[model samples]
Target: MTSGPAIYGNFTIDDLVYPNGSTRWGVPGGSAVYAAMGALLWTKVSSIVAPLGADYPITLLDKRIDLSRCRSIPKTMRNWGLYEEDGRRHFISRNESRDWTYFSPALADAASGYQAAAHIAPLPFEATKQLIEELRAGGTKSISLDMDDHDLLGNRSLKKMMELVSTVDLFMPSQQDVLALFPGKGPLEAMHQLRSLVPEVALIAIKCGAGGTIAHLAGSEEYLRIPAVHVEVIDQTGAGDAFCGGVLGSLARQGDLLEALLCGAVSASFCIEGMGFSSLLEATGEAANSRLERLRQRVERAPCK
Candidate 1:
């Protein structure tokens, strides 16, 4: 594989509450952490731009991940997600210390060398737009975005979402996110409507839990349905973020959409096998390739028109 571009992301800490009344507090969690791990599995140059709190354990991250761009903050960003018995998640609370409502010029400067490709994890609409603008101005070749249900259903305006989508090379959103974005529409209809909203996006990937992903490439009337890898799920947190990382990493290295999708599917499979990025610690390129081959066999392509 060719040398991958420097991958960058934002990070967060999580406080999870399960239906069983158990809780995991102050866990080192975020889209950046999972996405970086997924990218690291394919390439060595990966970094996360986040604010680290005094209480966070920086040593837990892999040595390959560069935290030079991250800031030191008085308190870490905290989020609460309550899981129901039916696998639905409800975010109960959020306390953000360092406001990322707008883009950070310091982060833009730190991201100078790694402009080959970047993945913007779930952030405020304004932040996402600003980051994309900064990266594009800094000569970044490819940019990807991952949107969650919260982002879709939150206070963001449709115009902001459309502008953000049109700016990125790839837009990866969960099934629930798409449903929320285009309410009262089926998956295909929602995807088409989204495509109409952001006709310039090179690819739109809808991530379906357990079922897999449906990816539509620009200028193509057909889309690929890539199935998810079967695994015994331990915790579902960060799976989608890992998937975004895998795709961005693969695309940066190989520039092939199909390969990227497969890599993402495999990465997500590993993420779900254990709790909070633990399974990924034991993941190898060989193992990922093995699963990739299996998933490639199950992928189906059909016309979207």
Candidate 2:
């Protein structure tokens, strides 16, 4: 459904607390919430395919969640806490993050288009497989997966995990996750080495917290780098998810990989300036577009590459 409905994967609890002091802005966050909200900023309307706790402030859910694509899974909500100091952030609490339980969708989403995306913050590998199967059943056209800062083999079997990646279109992770996966290799070299992991993948976005991001695709001789949007960062918790949310939506909107990457960069630039999804939800598509345009203008003014 070009406009009927959209679905976002992954939902977690995020709490932002200042270690040093309070910032000018802050809010509740999660990779799933931020990205889903980001997608909503442009996609007209969409549903979130996630679960949440029974006590998950029904008001917030009423305000931000669409229940149509939502699935009730175990421990549905995440319990997380974010502490920030001098622009750096640390997660002080986290438990039962990705709790998807089913093997498939109980009811097919009544929509024509499905831009299936998941923040594989280590959802049970079996659940991920089943989720993908469900997406396929629903005729999902594009799928993007993000691996967070965890041992690549922790929650899932290695072979099964790689097989899952092959079935998707975009595979990404934070730069730190890449290092943990393949220790000792320089970032560029490690990216080149990623080819051995997922040869069928389209784009591999490596997110650099507070730094920037770079995308590597198969057959590309060089990595495409996008610098970070400089700002007084309050929290870095959900920025990566925001980037993927932008890529998925923009790619769906324009059918342009490079343009989507640029959008992801611009979206992420906006994601880091605040605590979580609030900053993103606070801006309309027009506002985001204008902000991105200005960022582009700044990019043009930088010393020519």
Q: What is the TM-score of each candidate against the true structure?
A: 0.90, 0.77
Local lDDT at 216 for model 1: 89
lDDT of 2 by residue, 111-175 (tens): 32355443333344555566667676777777777753443636655565578778778876777
RMSD of each: 2.7, 4.9
Q: What C-alpha lDDT do the candidate models reach, one value each?
A: 0.77, 0.58
Model 2 local distance difference test score: 0.58
- By TM-score, how accurate is candidate 1? 0.90
The runs of at least 3 residues in candidate 2 whose Cα sits more than 4 Å from the true structure, single-residue gaps closed, are 1-10, 15-27, 58-65, 72-76, 82-122, 151-160, 294-305
Per TM-score, the best of the predicted structures is 1
